[model samples]
Target: MRKFFLAVSLVLTSFSVFAVNSSHCPHSCPSGTPSSNFVVFRAPYTLSNNATTKFADWVAYRIAPDTIQGGRSRNFRADPLLFSSRTLEPDDYTGAHAQIGTDRGHQAPLASLGAFSDFQALNYLSNITPQASGLNQGPWNILESRVRGLVQGGGFNEVFVQTGPLYEFFFAELPGANERHTVPSGYWKVIYTNVNGNIQTAAFIMEQTTPRSSNFCFHQVTIDEVEARAGLNLFPNLSGASTVERRTGFLRNDLGC
Candidate 1:
């Protein structure tokens, strides 16, 4: 009987490991919802109708779902099983080609993740976007730099960032390898700052394109909008942000999407 009980215990332990390792476990925070197969981590705060003001609020991707990579080349769809969102449309801002003069910019610049050894992971199309070459490589990069500086200065432990496409007036669809094609009008970014051991979050959203807009004229948005659209909170204190944020961002940026 003792031997049988031990055997059963081992089986149960193995099963638990399997469940966590299976890649099907929900990794998101608004708990009880089905997990996204590819979700690496879920944020803790619930999605609010208003944009978030904190800089440290953000969500992290798990693993990419197989469905997105198959030869079909259909519209990339995030599996509902893994995430809970009012909208599941492909991240339109990422990887979409811009007009003849525009460049696809990355809010989370690829260079930011240079420290990671698995550099290929940072090349995934999911992390890219279309922006004016000057802007993307300029002010956008500046923002990233500023944030990193803050982290290094010890002003905060971790910063949460939520970014997305900004669509203003519609434009004509461009032909591409995939069926649907349209350039996002602009982009939105929200940041949550963890300062003085208090979880203070700040958000910044911007619309970068307008006929009269100068390269430096990107408009910042409010926190409420970000939370409503992103459907997730900014930070949960599992690991210390000061050490983990830079490390994880560098890993994800250098490795892939």
Candidate 2:
């Protein structure tokens, strides 16, 4: 049993040096990552953690009709696979909610994997980030729901979503954290699906101050633009420049943006 647990630990914290093997990602796990970022696979989603920020550099997951069920577990905890120096505990978010109007937002939302019994992995702090309450509850929350609608509404077989934070400018520190954990300046997301044998993609970048009622379409960007801002090579296994190039009005109508 001890050997089994040891092997499990090795598998869970598998370094990104190996190609990520998960059903959740689009083509392949994002490539061209920072040295500090390490990959950890959970039952529901896969994330690359950034030791510097004590947060994920990026998270990839797929949402299907059946996956979006059940209520939020909300049982946030530290990731056992990460070192305490590179991860946050529940106390790290103590005063943040009220003092800074920040939220312990899930990069891989729990609601998206509600159908799975082990969805608690989504609650791990390594998969959570300090996001402004307004942004987390407002446009960001809406966008997450929109992705689910695509799967539930039968508009797509499944929706592939990749998201991460942006540090374009200085950010505040989480008041409750004993260690330094800088808040993200903004966030980025890329949603993609196959339509008629062609890949259609939509991307967006939202600041921490995005209005709750903001129009989601107004923030639409290209995959390449998000790559530059977030320092990630998204969907590297997919071919064709059209998929990565900026599309001013790509999939706006389908997304109801």
lDDT of each: 0.36, 0.80
Angstrom error of the Cα, residue 40, model 1: value is 6.6
Model 1 agreement with the true structure over 1-257: per-residue lDDT tens digits: 54554354345334422332211112223221122212221111112110111011223322111111212212334322221222223443334345433554543344444333433333333344445555565655555555454445434445554455544556333333233334555555544443464443334444444332232223333444544544433332234533332221232221111
Task: Quote each prediction's TM-score.
Answer: 0.49, 0.91
* Regions of candidate 2 where Cα sits further than 4 Å from its true position: 1-18
Q: Report the CA-based lDDT of candidate 1 relative to the real structure.
A: 0.36
Tens digit of lDDT per residue, candidate 2, span 1-257? 54554365456445555556567776788776665566777668888887788888889988888788767668899987777887899998889888888889989888877887788888889989989888889888888877787887747888888999999887578887899776899999988887776777789999988877887778888888998888777876677755456675666777787
In terms of TM-score, which candidate is strongest? 2
Worst 10 residues of 2 by lDDT: 1-10
Query: Model 1: residues >4 Å from true position, as ranges?
Result: 1-99, 171-175, 210-218, 228-257
lDDT of 2: 0.80
